[model samples]
Target: MSQLTIVGLGPGPRQQLTAEADAILQSGQPLYLRTQVHPLTADLPAFTSFDSLYEESADFADVYNGIVTRVLATLADGPVVYAVPGHPMVGEQTVAKLIPQAKAAGHTVRVVPGVSALEALYASLAIDPSAGLLILDALTVTPETLQPTLPTIILQVYLPRIAADLKLTLLERYPDDHAVTMVQAAGDPDVERSETGPISQIDRLGWIDHLTSLYVPPTDETVEYEPDGESIDGMVRLVDTVAYLRSPEGCPWDQEQTHKSLTRYVLEEAYEVVTAIEGDSPDAIEDELGDLLLQVVLQSQIAKEAGEFDIDSVAARQAAKLIRRHPHVFGDQVADDSETVLVQWEEIKATERAAQARVLDGVALALPSLVRADKIQRRAARVGFDWPDVQGIWDKVAEEVTEVQAAITSGSKPAIQDELGDLLFAVVNVARYLNVEPEEALRQATMKFTERFHRMEAAAKAAGQDLSAITLAEWDRFWNAAKGR
Candidate 1:
């Protein structure tokens, strides 16, 4: 039977090669190497290497596929010995693809393991892998795959551009000034090199090559990895903190709170976030957003204790809803503009609300009256029960204003209230047609009026006159002065 033997070249030193692998290389059989880039390849017996395929292929996948095809074709001739750098099983794409295919072709396969790069890395860095460690590929690094709370080792940082891309992804979770270590030729003392510096300068190192790897230690100030199953990421740490606050040994006020009791705080925090955004201070916005997020985590914790749901489920459900509704982004649906996106969004929402008894049923009644009116008007407009244009809405506002004057002249309290509400609703419709949020517009108007009134009060105090005792003409004068200032 034709035999296929896979051997490891051990990390770069001749001493690290296994005795079993050395015996096979010296057996004078047909020898093949995955690449000739390693230090040990110079002293080895005559062999054929697939290094030329790397230059001819477009990508690593094509190179790996080409290597596997040549190796399997060579195996059909006679017994063969295939050697790859480090351990044959560790990050060797060609070896992984060749073994099963060779076995299926009625060939006996044997793997002789040698010292892997990970073993040499541990010895070079003097770090224990028993602690939490996250190993990632530089080519495939992503925000979702990174865990900054654990000591991470990134492999295959073969090029400067790959390192630069990895640095950007890491910067999302790790600070730019965070310390990182680069190691090259881990076990070979003759040519080994290691450097420690800020992650921001990783791509500037000129000595980086195919053998280089990066090490990022966990940042305790940003996020911590708890061995007791308490936390793994920043969000998980927040969830754990909230869970502890509701525990028996935790805060009394937090332990006594229910979901219903926390509703008011949720609304208050949301409004404070809006106020902070309006103030346009980054620090205030971040703080207020954290406060708002706390409410969500706390409510999720309460639900978890009640066996209802948790934060993970809430986030997953929301993610699913967003992906499902955004077919233009997540699917093949094409939406070129914001208006088209909104139309697609509403169509998706309408399908989700298909079980509802009415078009306006999902608009919460607890929303502010102006916001609720805007939502109600939008819902009606979707069903074609709306004015054709902004001009029609303006005409309706004038008609409602006339009715309010007639009702006030008739001296009917209910009639006046009804007409005033009609006029406000018509105005809200005009605001919606103009693409303005009525609630936010009214809030800005109210704030401006309050500021001007305070200025008028100051003017009255400076003139030694009580505001209540001022005549209409005097009030007008003060108001004009305030406006001018």
Candidate 2:
């Protein structure tokens, strides 16, 4: 088989380069360096560099692809030695592509490890990486993708523009005054430089290049989850914790919980999540949302113990349903708008429930009245049982209002209650036609009223007057002033 040898050139010069990597470089085989811009590449034997590809290509992805294509083509003639800065497997996108392609084509590929930037970073910072360290590439990471609980190392921060971008991304999870360390050409004592300052001023440090990496210490007072330890670590830990809680020797309270009994906690966590979102705090929302997910996990665990179904089955059923329902997204169906998509979704659901006798078969009776009214109308509309236009909807509302007045005048309590319910249902229909959630709209309106009433009371107290003693005219004036403010 044809041979491909991938080698690491260490973080900097000859002093940092490993003996095996040095020997591979000195071998007479045809040599290729990812870039000639590195300090040690100048001292290596005569070789070709892919640095020129970076100039000709539009982006790093194109450059990496071009390098892989060129290397594979060269392997057709004879064995080739490919060298890259730092460890080949550490943040080297090109080698990741080359190894898989080479293996699939029956070429034997060898990876020669050398000191990576991570080693130099640890030395420069004098910190123990054994506890928890997250290494990420500067090009592909953003604020949303960052896990801020662990100390982080951002590699290949090779441009001022990238540094500026990284600064902004970090500021989302970190304070502007948060300190960060910049380690350049680590392990080469002569050329190495480390600077520490606020993340906001990282771009101003000057001379960002290929050998640069940024060290971000964990921010103080961060209330997020503990170092997810690793990517799958959190999930594994959650599963284990839940299993332990349900064990015989575990917490008595947790042991007593059944799927049916835990339903209240599920509803409470959902409302808490909604409250956190309304508060507009991302961290609070993230935390509360995790609590909501815990309820799902707990219920699933209980179901598993009862031999009904496991979490995997729950996930599989949900995924299958989503794909089956979203024919436009997962299949070759064409839906132009959300209205068309929803219609198709309802049709798919109807097909799933073909054995049911009623058109409103799947509408949950346990839902809030406003939401339930909306769902009933949606189902009726699907079958062309809806009003002709907005005028018809308004006329229905008027009719319900008049019926409520007649019932009130007749002084029949049950009739009055029934007519009032009809009026509310009609109002919910109006909310549905206007594409609004009646429950949330009413909740917000009630909150506004409460705030205004409190403000009027405060103003009355400041004026040395009691609200109970105020006349109706004076109360109206106070309410209008509160509304104006």
Please, what's the RMSD in Å of model 2?
20.7
Q: For each candidate, what TM-score against the reference? A: 0.51, 0.49
Q: Candidates' lDDT values, in order?
A: 0.86, 0.84
RMSD of each: 19.3, 20.7
Best-fitting candidate, scored by lDDT: 1
lDDT, model 2, position 37: 83
* Over 4 Å off, model 1: 1-232, 406-415, 462-465
Show the lowest summed lDDT stretch of 10 residues, model 1.
223-232
Q: How would you encode candidate 2's per-residue C-alpha lDDT over 1-485 as one tens digit per residue?
A: 68999999988868888898889889889999888888886687889999888778744556889999999999998999999988999999899999999999889999999899889889888889899988888865655467677899999787775686577567656777888899888898988988999999998878788789999998674423333434334654575467568775578999888777887888789889988998899999999999998988888777655444555567768999999999999999999999999889878988887888887888887677877898998778878988878788899999999999999999999999999999999998888888899989987998799989999999999999899999999999999999999
Could you tell me which residue pairs clash in candidate 2?
A: none
Give candidate 2's error at residue 435 in angstroms: 2.9
Residue 256 Cα positional deviation in candidate 1, in Å, after optimal superposition: 3.0
